[model samples]
Target chain A: MAGYGTARQDHLRRLRRIEGQTRGLQRMVDDDKYCIDILTQVSAVTSALQSFALSLLEEHLAHCVAEATRNGGPEAQEKIKEASDAIGRLVRS
Target chain B: MAGYGTARQDHLRRLRRIEGQTRGLQRMVDDDKYCIDILTQVSAVTSALQSFALSLLEEHLAHCVAEATRNGGPEAQEKIKEASDAIGRLVRS
Candidate 1:
């Protein structure tokens, strides 16, 4: 969870930029920009989102997962499993 | 180029949904959603953008590149090289 004031601000800002990039893709399509050019932009946005997700995962592992691991219970296993699944999804996606 | 009426419309619609997905991510972060849930949504958005890129690339191949190939000139090689570079970027990203 990224609810802290500064963390939340950082996420919103990144998402806003990603949203802007998507809008730019729309404009590129509307204007009939070169195919390769549009594809380049799409890759840019995808990479941006990918990096964002990676950082979020790192934070999750550091905070929530780390806390659970410290507690040493069935919940710790559950948290580890959940985080593993999330990482799998990210890689496969 | 996706400047045609229906084709452009389709592209724009897809981008709009991707943008919506991104905004939803912001909301999830703001709401302090579970880390795995946010990560899942991020993967979804990434996959959506990826598929969109693939389709657009298909169209480019079917149209622009196809046309260049039919003409049989250096331009065909250029188009192919450009497309390959774009695909590389997508895969690397």
Candidate 2:
């Protein structure tokens, strides 16, 4: 797999932040916070994570998929299928 | 605020699934799963949640923002600002 390098670091940071948010959510539930309030926080955390995914997907396209396309043949086809499957998953999610 | 109705239900279902995934993650940790394995599952759950978020964001943009934009004037500006802020947060996340 192609390394994301700097982008990987940024993503890890975001993931760690999201992990903290998830822990906070668990705490909120344990503390019996208002349902609506907890839901709102959940929404925020979801959005943040989604943004991170979008960034990663963008990077994959700009680098991995693009590189595969440039190379052509079976590898390109596989990359295209992978990207399509990913997008399909996102759409149905 | 306008309701998402069926779309809301879909989102809720997806969220519930994600909640289950999160619990599974916790269990994985409790069971002392290998670091790389846990990280792989974490990535999967993160991607699933991100897909859910992206769906919600797309709906918001297509529905709420579009409605506001059609209305024009101060409300339009507010909606536009809201969407921009949301995108900004997603980018920075």
Interface RMSD of each: 2.3, 8.4
Q: Write the per-residue lDDT of candidate 2 for residues B13-81, one digit (tens) a residue.
A: 665666666666555445544333444555677666556545655766777778878988798887777
lDDT of 1 by residue, A1-93 (tens): 342334777778989999999999989888888888899999899989988888788888888888989998999999999999999998998
Model 2 vs. true fold: TM: 0.53
After best superposition, candidate 1 residue B66: deviation in angstroms? 0.5
Q: What are the models' TM-scores?
A: 0.94, 0.53
Can you write out model 1's per-residue Cα lDDT over B3-82, one digit (the tens) per residue?
23347777889999999999899888888888788899999999999988998888888888989999998999998999
Where does candidate 1 stray beyond 4 Å? A1-6, B1-6
Q: Where does the lowest 10-residue lDDT sum fall in candidate 2 chain B?
A: B30-39
* DockQ of predicted candidate 1: 0.70
The residue pairs in collision within model 2 are: none
Model 2 spans with C-alpha error above 4 angstroms: A1-3, B1-93
